[model samples]
Each structure stands twice: as C-alpha cells, then as structure tokens.
Target: MIVLDFVGVGLFAATGALSASRKQLDIIGFVFLAAVAGVGGGTIRDLILGVGIFWVLEPVYIVVCGGTAAVIYFTAHLLESRYRWLLWLDAVALAAYCVFGAYKGLLVTGSPVVAVVVGTLTGTLGGILRDALANEPSILLRREIYVTAALLGALAFVLSDAIGLPQPFSACAGFVVAIVIRGSALALGLPLPTYRSRPGREHGAIR
Candidate 1:
C-alpha cells in the first residue's frame, strides 16, 4: 500500500508538471500543480472518511511530489510529446490509486460501496483538479472511459475481496482492470457514447 501510494503520487505529480510544461509555467507553478495533483484526491478521501490526511502524517508524499515536479521540469523539454507521456502516466497512476484508495476505504469503513466510490474519486480527482487549474480540457469532459475505468477497477477490487481473494491479488486485479481499460482507450480510441438531442427538439421545451 505504501509503495502504491508513492508510485501513484509520483506519477500523478509528473503529469501535473507536464501540464505546467505545456502551459509554459514557472518552477513554482510546476511544484504547486504537482503537489495538488499528487495529493488532491487522497486528501478529499481522508477528509470524507474522517481520518488524518496521509501526507499530513508522513510528509514524504509532498516531498515526492516536489521531487517529481523538479525532475519533469528539467527533462520535459526533451520529450517529443509530453501530452502522450502525461496520458500514459496518468493512466497508470489512476490504476494504482484506485486500488490504494479502495483499500483505505475498506480499512476505515468496511463498506464495498464506499470503497468503490472513494477509489474512483482517488483515481480521477487529482487529474481533474490538475486540468482545471492548468486550463486544459478536463478529462471528465472527454468522451472516453476514464472515470468508468476507475469505477470498474474499484468494483473489481471490492468484489474480489468479497470473494475471499488475497489482498495483494485483489489489488492486482483492480489495477489490471483499470490500466487495461484506460490503456485501451488511449491506444484504440475507445469512447463512450455521448448524449445527443433529437434534431426536431426545441431548446428547453417540455415534453
């Protein structure tokens, strides 16, 4: 769990730094965005669960986020496509965070439904915040399977645990489910169907 938390924080922080890079922001911006993207979701989860925030307790997570930002700031220009890197890194982080968040939720509440919701939020909220702050297109606005992937991954973990699976195995199962779904969406352009109003419908007209 500790390892997953660190990995997810670092990767998400890197994505935040990449967003800063795209915006041509300064080092301070990189650090700020990275820290927010790294800890935003988990902070919300801990707050909702009435637990001590993870970073507030350890502090290493913030250090990791800052370090990740510094690294990306120095090397991001070398990449031919920073957006591609951000997408893939965010996908992996989302996978890991979903499992970590769900595990934490289960520990606190022992409720599968809460676990799933918290896991999904943990996986996606940081990126959502990052994009909003960066003035980029929100991932939630994309017609892809981003949030759905996280939700299904969390559900997978809870279901696997309920079926008496080992903790590590269940975590792996959730991570795999999330990454596979997200990766496929990235690679194959899989998208969710969007709602469309009927052509003959008038705006704001009641049925």
Candidate 2:
C-alpha cells in the first residue's frame, strides 16, 4: 500500500506540473503545484481519519514530487500533448489511490459506505485542489463521468474485499474498473446526465 501511494504521488505530481505549465507558471509554481496535487488528497484523508499525515511521516514522497516537478520543468517543450498526458496520468493515479483509500478506510472502519466515500475522495480530491488552485474548470463541476467511476471502483473494492477476495487482487479489480471508466469517458465523450431546472420551478413555484 505504501508503494502504491508513492506511485500515485509521482503520477499526480506530473499532472500538477502539467497544470502549472498550462498557466505559464514558474519553477516554484510547478513545484508547489506538484507537491499539492501529489499529496493533497491523502493529506485530507489522513486528517479526516485522525491519522498522522502520510507524506509528513515519510518525506520521500515529497522528494518524489519535487523531483517530478524538476523533470517536468526541464522537459516542458517536449510535451506537445501535455494535457492528454495529464488526463491519463491523473486517471491512473486516481484509480490507484481509490483502491488504497478503500483499503485504508476498511482498516479504520468497518462501514462499507464510509470506505466507498473515502475511495472517491482519495481519487478526486487532489485533482479538485489542483483545478481550484489553477483556476481551471474542475471535473467535479462537469457532468463528465468522473466521480461515478471512483464510486463504482471503490464499491467494487469494498465488495470484493468483503467477499474474501485476496487484497491485492481486489485492489487491482477496483483500479481497473476506475481506469476503464475514466478512459472511456475521455475517449468517447461519455457523461452523466445533468439536471435541468424546469422553467416554472426556476422561480420556486411548480407549474
């Protein structure tokens, strides 16, 4: 699980650097963005779960993000397709972290619902923070199939674990589900339905 968390940190750090690049930020900005996007979700999760901060306890994760930012800063010109790369990389991190979060949630509490919520938060919170800091349109605001993917993936992990599946296998299953769903959304423009307020209801009176 620790290894998986580090992998997620690196992947998310790259996405954060990509986000900073899109805004024409400087080297410091890149590092800041990478650091936040890499561990923001996990930090929040730890806080909510009343545990020690993961990266604070293991400073190597911060080093990984810093190194990733430096690399991205130096190689910026080579990434003509940075946005696409960021999207895919973020998706991978999201899925991986979702499984990890679910696992941790199960450890902290026996409630499957809470575990699923934690999974969703673990998958999307970092991206949310990145988008907010960058002043970009967030995935949560769009009807794109983002959180739904996380939810299903988390649910899958929790259910699989509950049914006595091997831990690693269960995590893999959840990760695959999230990545496939998110990838399909990216490739096919698949989206969840958006609510449309009725004309009469807009004024708080039913027709």
Candidate 3:
C-alpha cells in the first residue's frame, strides 16, 4: 500500500537529514536534504508514468517527508555510530522502498518490467539528488555497489512474479534480495566492476 511507501520515504528522509547533521550542515540544510531524499524518487516515478506528480496530488506525501525532516533536525545525534548509525537503516529503507515502488508500478501501471525500473528509480534517485545538491559527487560515480543491485533485485522479483509467485511473497522476497545484496556489499566492501578508463581519463584512484 501507499502507506508503506510513505513509511519507507520517511525513514529515508530521517537518514538523509541525519547524514547532513553529521556534516554540521544547518537545520534548514538538513530539512532540505531530507525532503530531496524523500521526494526525489516519487517525483521521478510520477514524471515517468505521466501521473501528474504524486506529491503535488497528495499533501500527505509532503507532510510525511516534512515531519520526518523536523524530527531528524532535533534527533539526528541520537543515532550514533555505535548503532552503525545511518548506513544500515538506509539499506533497510532502500529495500522497502524498492518493493514499494515496484508494487506501485505493477498496480498503477500494470507492467512488471516497468515496475522494476520504477522501483530502482524510486529507491535511488533521491540519494543521487541528495548527493548532487550537497555539492558532493553522485553515488553513481563511485565504484560502489548501489542502485544497480537494487534494479537487479527488482527485476528478479518480476521474474518470480512471472513464474507465478504471489504478490505478497514476491514483494517479501524482492525486499530481502535487495537488502542481502546491499548488506553484503557493505560488509564485504564490494566494489562495482569497472572497465579500463578512456584514453584521456584517469583511473585507479579508488583502487
């Protein structure tokens, strides 16, 4: 349901704002980052689907994002590194949001393949926008296993569904697959497989 999507969105907002806080950004910066990270995916989905933009159509979405932002503004430091802080939570949020977006694409648009793409877009665009807006490089530029893994997991869900998996079971499996893939990446320091750099470009910085 959309409520679950909003919950995942809220968690993401909190984590983004928390990250901004760790960087010593101002309260307004944290809130703005939270909103960007929260709404970015939904906006992409709406735009792709020609659905008149979800947040514009629903004030609940904005309210949920804003509320999470405010909470994070005050409680950011509550999540210390001792708890593994934001990373683990963000991973979980990513998994849930992926499933949520895929569900929307399937239900709203009735296309499993498109659903997978939408899921990946929904789960990742926010993080990309967040990083770029903060004057940091996009996560897509790193040799890190990130949104591509999400897309793969989402597509796997579509495959499972095509093979007759029930909606609930498929969603659960997809969510777990994403989390495992991402968690393994984090735990094992999995880097994205890279090719040789172009003729004029430098490489091996992270290597």
Candidate 4:
C-alpha cells in the first residue's frame, strides 16, 4: 500500500513537472511544483482525518516525490507530447489515490460515506494545487466529469468493501472505475450539463 501510494505520488509529480515546463519554469520551480502536486492531496487528507501525515511518518514517500520531480525535470523535453501523457498519468494517479484514501478512511472511520469523501479528496486535491501553482484553471472547476469520476471510483470501493470483498479486490475495483470514467471523458469529450438562463423565466423563481 505504501509503495502504491508512492507510485501515485510519482505520477502526479510528473504532471506537475510538465505543467511547470509549460510555464517555462527553472529546475527549482519544477521540483517545487512537482513536490506540491505529489503530496498536496494526501497531506490534506491526513490533516482532515486527524491522522499523522503519511509522508512525514514515512519519509521515503517524500524521496519518491522528489526523485520523480528530478527525473521529469531532466527528461520532460524528450517526451514527444507532454500534455497528452500527463493527462493519462494524472488519471492513473487519481485512481490510485482514490483507493488508497478510501482504504485508509475505512480503517479510521468505518463509514462508507466518509471513506468516499476522503477518497475523492485524495484523488483531486493535488491536481487542484498543481493548477493553482501553475496559474492554470483548475480541472475541478471545469465542466468535465473530473470530480464525478473520483466520486464513482470511491463509491465503488466503499460498496465493494461493504459487500465483503477483499481489500485488494475492492481497491482494484475503485481504481478501474476511476480510470475508465476519466479515460472516457478524455477520449469522448464527456462533460456535465451547465445551467443556462432562460431569457424570461429566470426572473420568476426567486421573488
């Protein structure tokens, strides 16, 4: 589980590095953004849950994030299409983090609802920080089904756990659901509907 968490951190760090590159940042900036993106979500989750921060408890995770950033800093240019790869990598990280967060939440709270919320936060908070630091619009605020995908994945994990599935199986179910939903959105351009004001009807409901 620790290794899996680190893998998610690495993936997120890569995306962060790429985002920094897009903004023409130096290596220091790249590493800083990468570390932030890698651990922001998990740090937030741990704080909210009143659990000790994972990376602080286990410094290896921080090393993984830093090492990942350094690697991406050096090799980012070699990647033919950074944005496309970053999207897919971010999806994978989201799925992994969602499952990890829910699993931890279950151990702590034993409530499916809490687990799902924590999982969703685990999946998205890092990306939100990444975007903010990069001066990019947050994916969470976009009309696309980003948060919905995380929610579905977390829900699946909780449901599976509630049904007596093994830990590994439940986690896998969550990860797969998240990846499929996110990948579908990326490939098919799926988006949630937005509210539109009707020319005359908008004024009738409030007063």
Best by TM-score, which number? 1
TM-score for each of the candidates: 0.94, 0.92, 0.84, 0.91
Task: Give the whole-model CA lDDT for all candidates, comma-separated.
Answer: 0.94, 0.88, 0.76, 0.87
lDDT of 3: 0.76
Give the C-alpha lDDT of model 1.
0.94
Tens digits of per-residue lDDT for model 4 on 98-156? 88888888888888899999999999999999999899888777666898888899999
Ranking by TM-score: 1, 2, 4, 3
Q: Write the per-residue lDDT of candidate 3 for residues 1-207, one digit (tens) a residue.
A: 555577668877876786677678887777778888888877888888777887787777778777787887777666657124566666777788887788778778888889999989887887777777766666677665889767876776777777899877887788888889988887887887667675443566545
Error of 2 at 136 (Å): 0.9
Total clashing pairs for each candidate: 0, 0, 0, 0
Which TM-score value belongs to model 4?
0.91
Between candidates 2 and 4, the TM-score winner? 2
Q: Give one digit per residue, the lDDT tens place, for model 2 in 1-207.
A: 776687778999999999999999999999999999999998988887888998888898999999999999999779779888888898889888888888888899878998999988988999999999998899687656988888888989999999999988898899889999988987888887666763334655635
List where candidate 1 sits over 4 angstroms from the true fold.
Answer: 198-207
- Per-residue lDDT tens digits for candidate 1, residues 1-207, read 787888889999999999999999999999999999999999999998899999999998999999999999999989999999999999999999998999999999999999999999999999999999999999898867899999999999999999999998999999999999999999998997757664555767856
Best by lDDT: 1
Could you give me the TM-score of model 2 versus the true structure? 0.92
| 191 Cα displacement, candidate 1 (Å) | 0.8
Q: Quick one: ranking by lDDT, best first?
A: 1, 2, 4, 3
Model 4's alpha-carbon lDDT is 0.87
lDDT of 4 at 120: 94
